[model samples]
Target: MILKTYRWSFVVTALGLVLAAWYGLSAHLGIGQAIALVLILSILEISLSFDNAVVNATILERMSDFWRKIFLSVGIIIAVFGMRLVFPIVLVSVTAGLGPIEVIRLALEGGDPETPGTYGYELHEAHPTIASFGGMFLLMLFLNFIFGEKEHHWLGPIERALEKVGKLDYVQVIVAGAVLLVVAETFATEHGRTVLASGLAGIVTYLLVNGLGELFNVEDHVEHEDPATTSAGTTASGVNGPSGAARATGKAAFFLFLYLEVLDASFSFDGVIGAFAITSDPVIIAIGLGVGAMYIRSMTVHLVEEGTLAQYPYLENGALWAIGALAVILLLSIEVEIPEVVTGLIGLAFIVASLISSIRYNRAHPEEAHVEQHHAAQPG
Candidate 1:
């Protein structure tokens, strides 16, 4: 079942390995060094992105197989090229007033030894903007989830309280705006405005993209379901077609896919900047991160296919909480240099803690599914 569900992910992983080897060899870092660097980067990407996988799984499981395949296909390309390569280059070109080709050359050749200027240096210099935008967007993602009502609750009291207060509906937005401003002010005068603008951009971008997805979501707007599908949004044969059609238009699915792509970009901003610390070699960063991206894509599919999130409801809570923590760290790192390892470790810690909690919950509530069935049997 695992292999069949994630066959494409396996193909992607195999391709990533081969490309990593080739890219390393071409970099002339010696096969051993190249292999090691690629492996390290791949590991780094995976570690930093485990929460991403969990979040992705939560979203993807609700989508159709057709849309799911699109995510595995087009999504990874965007994650690879858009995030790992074009994003940093474009940022440098805009911030540093260099041409794209020149920026690419600088990134590949690394820093100028005597001049003390390099692509990594410029990219790092732009961390304020990167962090601000990515941080705010992620903060919103975390906050919205916490505030909204859901079936599962890992951290029951806190989440329940937040949901109760979430009646305001605008509280999260207001808090995010206030926090963004405070974070922006913390930056030096020179960096403050950029921070504010970037953070606002992040928030706006999140609202815009998410709002778009909701607009076209068939399920969200469906006044009533077709009797052919029962009440479960599935057809008689078990496919998820709302109207008993052969294929659902899946407009909402597609838009949410776009949202996921943008979300992936937000997550990648820091990693791209952080990869410089690991190795300034653009090829190495791309290949290493690419390998990790493939793995994440696969892991997301694995989680969904295996129903890991359903099995352990708290895992989603933990991942979203991790996202909140990561957003805070991103904003904090603007004023201070927080190592990439620290970021990775922080995320890993949340994940592990959530996992343990989930296990305990499972043991204590083995009839959780039965409870769900009891609720389902009741009429609205």
Candidate 2:
């Protein structure tokens, strides 16, 4: 029955294709060519993103079943609408002086709406700005992944320090705000503006969502933690879960989703640029890439439900390191001429090698195979 339910993956794949076709129809792409493009892009995206799904599963498996379901449903909306749709429009708005409606039209048309001379000129025109935004974005990701702090901050020393400074809380807030403003004012470059606006948007979004979460205290999907399973399993307090394992897992899944979104955006950066390299038509690009995004999502859920990551832990780590490498490539692309398809191939090679290694590792580590079977058989 679990596997039967998971078969909804096919339905999702179908839905994505349908949407891509619709976009193609609106844009006047020939139906046959549109279908072919969608299929190719979908396969490419899915193959490239298999590692991402494994990484996600490693975290999502720990969430409560209810929360996992909610993640599958609601998170898809955020991925499709927020990242796939709204994000591109934001890029257009920031770089092209176009309002959202016109931006939507441009994307639907895949930039083919304008005359060849004008559309091609505008796209080339926006390349510098797009490259700038993408470059900084990828650099931040690389640094954060390779060098950023990874410690858990649940009531950590920083929080303790904040508590101690409660007497001067207003002063602390003011100082932090002033420091940020000064940095933004001092830079005053396009890159600087991008960083400020994006970072502030992120912080505001987090605060708003967190405030609501606390207000609602939605605990219906919280799971019982298991200590034997996780490092943080014994340390969590409150209704955090039984052993802290579940809570830690849920938290990790939330962040992992964020990381995947970032990676997806990065991948899209190159794909979008490269699509224009092929043709300036925005419809073909949308249909192709939209279908591609769908397949990636489906593969992610499949890898999770099938426990692929657990069956191959080294593969999971390898995929992460590969992602780190790709982050570097994306940042480098801001100034350099690395091909997006080449970057994709390298990432995919890492995942495929890892998959092979996982198969070999599982052959040697028979106990892991048994454990996965046991877990797979457990009732939700």
Candidate 3:
């Protein structure tokens, strides 16, 4: 089962390493150094994106198989070539007011990241806006998750309290707006307006994507019906066939797919920028990060197929908290230089703790474990 799930990841790793070797041999760096750099970058990306896989699994489980296939195929292309490679160049071009061709030339002519007019330098200069936009988007995701109701809870006291407060209307928006205001007023005083605008854009993007998903979702409108009927993909409530309440389909699935892609982009913002610290070569960065992204996609699919989220109920909660931590770190990074290792470690800590907690829960509630396992064994 494991081999079946990760077969494509292995294929991607092999291809990425070969490409990394070619780029290294073609460039000034030796093949050995290039391969080493790619490996390190790949590990860095995987470590930082573990929580991303969990969150993605949670969403992907609700999507139809067709959309899931699109995610693995078309979505991987966007994540690799688009976000990891082209997006950085585009960002630099816009921020430095240079043409895309010029930006590509500058990137190929890599120099010291500390030096002016270099690709790394220009990308670094755009970090504030990137942080603001990505930070706010991730913050909104974390906020909405915590402020919304859930059947299970991890960090029970805190989550319960937040859920109680969430009974109030638009609490998530109010809190997110307040945070943006504070960030703009204090930490981003120099580029306050820019930061504010970027943050607002992030918030709006989230609302648009999430709102569209909810608007198109048919499950909410399905009336309460017999469990047997619902399980058979026919609700007595008159919602017929497989689209009844089992999975998102049609326009609803598309928006959820969009939301997942945007979430992936938000997660990648920091990884792309931090890649420069390890190597300034764009080719190596893309090869390495692209390899890592493929594995994350595989992991998401594995988690969904195995029903890992159902088996370990608190996993999603932990991932959301880690996202909240990351969002805070991104916002704080605007004023203070938080190390990428620090960000990665903080997220890993949350995941590890949650896994241990899940184990304990399963031990104490063996019957619940049996129930979850039975459900997991059933098809979506």
Candidate 4:
């Protein structure tokens, strides 16, 4: 079933190959170079976003079948086009006051990568604002995950201690706000105000999206007062039938969907910006990132179907830490340029360590893993 679910990934990847060939022909690039670059881009995206896939799987499992389909389908469109294409255009349009046609021209054909005049080149000029917003949102995501009371921990004492700190009233917001201020102050005078404004906006966006999702979830809970139970008497979502989780409609699901989109966008911000390093061509960037995103969605489904998260709890912990590191790097990038490879490696390192840690945990606490697996069988 999991393999079948990834059929779309195969299709998208095939299309990426086609697009890569066409791009190479147009750019007069060697065929080998084109395919190689695409492959490299795809691999880079997968490496940077594997943690994203795991995090998404956790959220996607709780969603209804309808919402999950929307996640894989409509969500992919947004990830590919919205962030990869239109978002950059909008950013350039806003920063440069350029028209749509002009922005497209600038993005695709304008100045060389090394010099000004290209959209890719100009995008960095607004890096302070972009990084501020994206960095703060990512910071909140990281803070919430690490600060939450998790069921399992790879680093027991540290996570347990953080879980205790999570209980403090408004701790997430307070700490995030303080961190944002500190980062904003580091920005040079020319962009300090802009950075602060963008950072605050990012914080607000996270709060609003999260608060709305929670409010809608409360409504969903009220509407479905009677939760279903599994054979072992574990709790489940009432709407889910035998074949699948119940079709979760209503305002709650709607808000949750929006929250997820925003969350996904925040995760994608770095990849989109960092992509300019490899290729200045927006079309290629979109194709490569789109292909990569589809696989991520497929991998997410695979994880859910295989119950990877329940079996390996520390994986999510590592993803959260990686997110935290990325956020910090983004903040620092406001003042200094950090290579995309470094960011990818940092995340990959965390994931690899988490995998090893999870394996050790599974061996040491096989019974605990079994218990988690049993609970995982219940529909959310």
* TM-score of every model versus the real structure: 0.87, 0.65, 0.93, 0.89
Better of 2 and 4 by TM-score: 4
Q: What is the C-alpha local distance difference test score of each model? A: 0.76, 0.51, 0.85, 0.75
lDDT of 3 by residue, 90-194 (tens): 999998999999999999998878999999999999898899999999999898888877767889999899989988988888999999999999888987987
Candidate 1 residue-pair clash tally: 0
Candidate 2 at residue 191, lDDT?
A: 50
- Please rank every candidate by TM-score, starting with the best: 3, 4, 1, 2
lDDT for residue 235 in candidate 1, whole number 0-100:
15
Those runs of model 1 whose alpha carbons end farther than 4 Å from true positions after fitting are 5-10, 112-115, 187-190, 219-249, 369-380
Identify the leading candidate in terms of lDDT: 3
**Superposed model 3: Cα runs more than 4 Å off:** 219-245
The alpha-carbon lDDT assigned to residue 113 of candidate 1 equals 24
Q: How do the residues 1-380 of candidate 4 rate in per-residue lDDT, one tens digit apiece?
A: 75598999998998888889988888877667777777777787887788788777666665676777888889899988998789888988888788888999888784555687778777877788888888898888887876775656768889889879988988988999888777767554567888889989998998887677566665353223123421111011112122123323566567666766776777677788888888777877888888888888899888877767767768878877888898888888888889988998998899889988998888998998777677556654
Which rank order by lDDT, best down to worst?
A: 3, 1, 4, 2
Clashing pairs in 1: none
What is the per-residue lDDT of model 1 for residues 191-226, given as tens digits with 9 covering 90 to 100?
A: 889999999999999888877766776655333433
CA lDDT for candidate 3: 0.85
Local distance difference test, candidate 2? 0.51
| TM-score, predicted candidate 1 vs. hidden true structure | 0.87
Please say which candidate is ahead in lDDT: 2 or 4: 4
